[model samples]
Target chain A: MGEENVMSDDILVIAEHDGSNVVDVTFEMLSAARELAKDSGGKVLAAMAGGAALAGSLGAFDRVYLIDDPAVSNYSPEAFEKAFTHVVRDVDPGLVLTSTSTMGLDLAGGLSVAWPAPLVSYVVGLGREGDDVVATSQIYGGKLLAEVVVDSPHAICALIAGSFSGQPSPEAGSPDVETVSLEGIGPSRTSALAVHEPDSGGVDITAADILVSVGRGIGSKENLEIIEELAEALGAPLAASRPVTDQGWLSKPHQVGKSGKKVKPRAYLAFGISGAPEHLEGMRDSELIIACNTDPDAPIFDVAHYGTTVDLFDLVPELTECIQA
Target chain B: MVLLKQLPDLVEELEPSPDGTDIDREFIKFILNEFDDQALEEALVTKESSGAEVIVVALDEPEVDQVLYTALAKGADRAVKLTGVPAGTWVPTHLRAAILAPFVRELAPDLVLTGVQSAEDLDGQLASLLGGYLDLPHAAVVVGLEVKDSIARVVQELGSGRSVEEQITLPAVLGIQAASQAPRYAPISKIRQAMQAGGLEELEAPAPVDSADIAIAQVRIRRLYAPEKSTHAEMLTGDPGEVATRIAEILRSKGLVKA
Candidate 1:
């Protein structure tokens, strides 16, 4: 079932920050929002929950709604949702865009239900199909893509990182900034405690010229030693996919994914790692990539410069011996 | 304290139906979602640490009874199946929340936990929607959870290895990203024993009466297809040593491998 297509196509970008600076994803959204604005004819508006200082970076947008609330300044989920809902309810834009990041994931799903809008998430592609908003979402760990049609006048699209090229110009005065207070946010039952940065256990994988990454294909935690030997022979740091770290076989610092760390090493040797979009987002930009997996259809081959359907156990030991020789 | 979902196993090949809305699930192997397994583990761990009763729930499916039995094997106190939703059909996140709301209201537990996401829908959304529907506070991507008195302390994963700790009052919902430890395996004997005991409770509930819940996006999927191969890797056809030597040569040619 679809709704009547009205002309309230103004796009709202829920801008996020690294505490103080506007995030790069916000700019990419602006770039897409610019294209969408042409078709929309309505203005592009960015709602910054607490990003007043970073408003200067959003020159490409038409206007900025600065939710000037202190609770939102620090992200306690309850307060931030209340602050965002307050602005969205008042503005009532047609399309709401946010990144599918840690905070964005919560807001996208929460606000969609709270605002009562339909939401399309894990979106890699976004475009307007006449009156309908078309979104392509990566599902089943990037095994497949779903083409979704948002037949409603108002919708929310949570974009995956790197889906668009967004370079925000650091200029001001393009858009009017409206300062507003929290109108209806209730007392937050949730409160922040402290933040911990993932310790790399003294290894900075991002700085490595060559990264030897392993995925779930490595089999067991005891088998990690084989991959480690290869990394040692190659003079590289050992990195892994989320599953490996989630299993506690390695530290979070050794993780390569959208959530872990983005690395552009001189060479990335992936063993047994199927390239989920999340993992691909982190290491796909390496100078040269070589993938080893048992599955020929593994998506890692799509990004690898050279790939082989070799059993990682067989290939890894041989590769280590060759490197040592 | 725990909710679960069974999803199409990733190991199985997934093919889109001719109509293009969903995958051909008739031949697909169904398994508990990986994150949901972690949710169950977290709930069990919390029960051990904080002295609470752990109840596991899922929508009724042909294979759901086995999953519930497994949960029981892993130390869940009770198992419940909300039945009567058509099998082999898609249930949107909102409807799942709608269906579970009345049951949740009935239990009124201290905390509700579910996987941060499932392959089908809602990456870190199910718990959020459940919280909204039940008018409770919510958090997502929670990697660590600790309950004390009437508060839940959660270690939430932010991007780039950054994590923040947050405390929530009891009777809240959480989208659990992982348990403190990996899910423990249940023995085959225990699973068999739990299944024979047959204490799994069932309640029949159809789709909500106000199904029109007027969502803007109106969650109907249109098509499913594979991503185009914008680039394909050059397959290195050789012995393991030969492929390694070639990889070494390529790295050196790229000026990455130092002599």
Candidate 2:
């Protein structure tokens, strides 16, 4: 009976909270849930998780299952999965979805372990394929897109951020909120000893409004000072390709690429970076792309709207002085 | 101890020939991926610190056995090859279910370590899937690992300069990032022994868990071109002061200058 457990009325979406607050992705996932529920003729449920005051601000859901414990603030897969499993058991949704953030990946992976269900992650598009839900996934470094379906009763999928079009908030936007508490899932094996925030001006370059990206051709670490001066002059954050981060001239947080952050900066200024395909996938969505590299053969010029070929050592100081002037 | 894959003469991005049937030779070359080597180094260090025997596993063409031997020479106690596991014939999800699931069940190692993502695959999803199948705790982008009292302390790299420390129980899986550790060179003596031992345990291919579910529908490469070059160099022809002022004006026009 437990194995064949099924639900027909609701599609559940997990709520992502930022400590005591809610994150934007939670609403994004809800938007996705509402879409799926529309076709399935079901309602959407948002499961709010975290410490006190967390669920209060998260607005409405079909049934807001709240787990307000101090221990739920920091993410622990073991405890969160246990709490989430309990909620999933109670809600019994036909489909479950979460945003494909780092937390989403962890949650979905652990949930797959607990539920033993197939999970489709980083889904780019979702549509109906016959009776099943088909999702498009970018495979082989975005070179190929695959449309896949999990022909199972219970399906778990992770929605890629910035890939899906979100529905506007409901005009009425109020649903019954229920608080569900899990007892005795305690003593998390790991503890968040501390959250050490990096000193990258608080705004991550990958998530910055404006990004000034440097490359290996900057020649030396000292030359980075000129880039920094330009960044300061423009009020832009700094990012780098793998080479700059690998060289230890810039911290890893400022690194943007397939291995790094998927940034969508309003303006991306490339300084001396030879565009690696791996690097372009992460930041091609920038509103404006201006590249500066000495080698005319540098790849960064391909996708750049405006391009400049000049030695960074000579160009940086001049650019900084001009910005100051 | 766990196995990592190295496809001899494989490039990060294979250059397709004009016919699109075979890869171009010029763009293809081989090395133990910088990330996979980092994983191997972590497994070696964990063995040294805990005195647990370490083994290396690689699924590739026969030639890649040398990389496995290189792993042993760098201190892996043994190696296994799930032969016929074609290079590039893997997605992160399927690879874990195929290679790692049975391997984990059979070896039952206290821990399994792998590169966070392979240079060729670059899925960034393998570690979590392997950990999922093992039903074990997993930490990825792990830059640090230490063993004390049979518990593994791992520092996971969460981009944007944040790291989360997780203490996993024994028999957990960890995916090592390239930045996690420096790859160690194989000693000549160990290399000699490993070569003599052959460092290759040819094993039967893993049967697919789903023989025909969700197959790779097709692989289409619309375009493959090297990145184009930049030709617009804003040359400021003047004295240092004049050049600086012109550069400042350019920066201002580019909106790099504020106020």
lDDT of 1 at A198: 71
- DockQ metric, candidate 2: 0.23
- Which residue pairs in model 2 clash with each other? A234-B256, A275-A300, A299-B227, A308-B232, A322-B247, A322-B248, A323-B248, B3-B57, B110-B171
- Per-prediction DockQ comes to 0.66, 0.23
Residue A57, model 2, lDDT: 51
Cα deviation of A291, candidate 2, in Å: 3.3
Q: Each candidate: what lDDT?
A: 0.83, 0.64
Q: State which candidate has the highest lDDT.
A: 1
TM-score of 2: 0.73
Candidate 1 lDDT (Cα, 0 to 1): 0.83
Give the best candidate by TM-score. Answer: 1
Per-prediction TM-score to the true structure, in the order listed: 0.96, 0.73
| Cα-based lDDT at residue A66, candidate 1 | 88
TM-score of 1: 0.96
In model 1, what is the error at residue B166, expressed in angstroms?
1.1
Candidate 1, residues A199-268: lDDT per residue as tens digits?
Answer: 7779898999999999998877999999888788878889999889888888888999878999999889
